[model samples]
Target: MSVTMSPGRYRGLRNVSLPAADTFGIVAFDQRGSYRKMMGAQASYAQLCQVKSEIISALSQSASAVLTDPIYGMDAAMRMSPRAGLLLALEKSGYSGDSSYRKTELIPSWTAQTICQVGADAVKFMVYYHPESGVLAEELEALIKQVVARCHACDLPVFLEPMSYSLDAAVPKASAEFAAARPAIVIETARRLSRIGADVLKLEAPHDIAHNQDEAAWQASCEQVSAASAVPWVLLSAGVDFAQFERQLRVACAAGASGFLAGRAIWKEAATMSSAARANFMAEVAARRLDALLEIAARDARPWSDFYTLPQFDATWYEAYALC
Candidate 1:
């Protein structure tokens, strides 16, 4: 399917400023509560920032872009690696808390304009979505439209990540029932959000945790997601184990995924290791793992830019943009 967006937005998407714009093998470190949970109870903000920096330093050379959050590690990440392409996460965490159930909001300090000023290549928003949640779905669509308009005015590309979670009172979040329902829920949510005009879609692989190893089921899920997506879509690791994520990526790419924008599977261990060991671990362990994924993507992934016929650059066009 062809990408449907304005010419400016197309340029913005192409200008990812990565080693390869066609294929996005991005390393994401934009976790909050999840990172802390993966580490231990004592994981501090400072430690998170340090580990994020180490991951960027180690893997940025192999990765096309890096996704970082505004609060903890973005500044240090930007300062530490000027050449690496960066995408800033705009949303605040804790939306799932009982007090704030289904309320997704942007971080107070950073807006689309402000994020662009920080030299970000693009901006990303991760929304937890469930088709059954009527009011919440409407609220999220409104929020996405506002952000897309803001980003259009600023001429920045926006990536929308729609993740599924159960909202039914009777179905436990981790139960077999929730797992059984997630693949369809995820595909439908992607179709819904793709119509809202995001430049890119960062999706969770449709296979549930239990069915991840089922190749036939995964291929079916991938085909459904690829058919539903209007824009270029990439798969997120979703904290799955490295081998599982690697298999998921292969299946996704073969079934028409652009590539991957993975986080935890690439750098989860960095959070748990001591500061002294973090750098070495990132360089040796994390970098190698990322390289393996990149190899897989290069072998099987489709190029996002190839989906459209981009206009040839001429002297007049360069003059129009004041590039001369």
Candidate 2:
């Protein structure tokens, strides 16, 4: 079944969340459990929020939009991201089931309408997805379709991120075999999830940098992903080192990607530093890195307008708009 969406509602909102160029150089500050681990197991809530304040304050300057959770980073992004747009995370920190077949757990008492009421510009949901998950994949797909319907009803654009993982216990995720299989898995996942009423597909780079260094093959895989996705796609960093992630970003952009929504690769180093040091690093290093990525995106990435037809309206368009 085809998921329903009101294109007239979200196209303008989606354009508002992106920069003037419409290429996405988004900041992913939505890490929850991973953020706690970065801040250390014993780190207090204040300490974690402070870290968010420092990082989001600095990089939001260069970013087109900031992706943050409602728990800790929302306050920081609300204050710091004056020029950039805000995308709030709707799901919980981690998955529910075991690593073999993970399941997304959305936060209780949160709905798309409530997210809009909270003053967010857009909604983001990240789910663990795989083509071979059988029943689990169908369940996740259904959940995504439901979320999309809710969001579109409220006229909010949804950024859907589907993270891929290894299904076989014998071949661990870090193994070369898994890396070799990553391109096909990622491409097929994009094909599957892009049809589920998402306004934008936040995707993994099809080429695995750790196991492969072939730039040509990397670009080819990225181009395939671009072709497979029905909507415009942006690459996720997936916590690779900055240097390698930079390389991946370039290739993806060259292969017709819209831009990126990255997290750890840019600011993971500053999470462990003192407030002053973190501030300095974010301002000097992370901000500059974002500037560079934005430069790359401006040069090569396709604008999101390529996917959605931006609506033209008369001055009385809002008279017909539904506030419910």
Best candidate, lDDT-wise?
2
Candidate 2's C-alpha runs over 4 A off are: 1-18, 314-320
Which pairs of residues collide in candidate 2? none
- Per-residue lDDT of candidate 1, residues 189-272 (tens digit): 878898896878999888776545689899998889888877778999988889888889989999888889998898887777
Per-model C-alpha lDDT, please?
0.77, 0.84
Compute the lDDT of residue 324 as modeled in candidate 1.
Answer: 5
On a 0 to 100 scale, what is the lDDT of residue 203 in model 2? 89
lDDT of 1 at 268: 82
What is the C-alpha lDDT profile of model 2 across 1-324, one tens digit per residue?
222335544453454345566788888989988788777778999888888977888887778878888889866966785777778899998998788889998899988888888777788999999999999999999999999889877888888999889998788878899998989999999899998888888988887788889999999999999889888888899999888989999999999899999998899999999888988898888988888888888888988777666555788877777754
Task: RMSD for all candidates, in order, please.
Answer: 3.1, 2.5
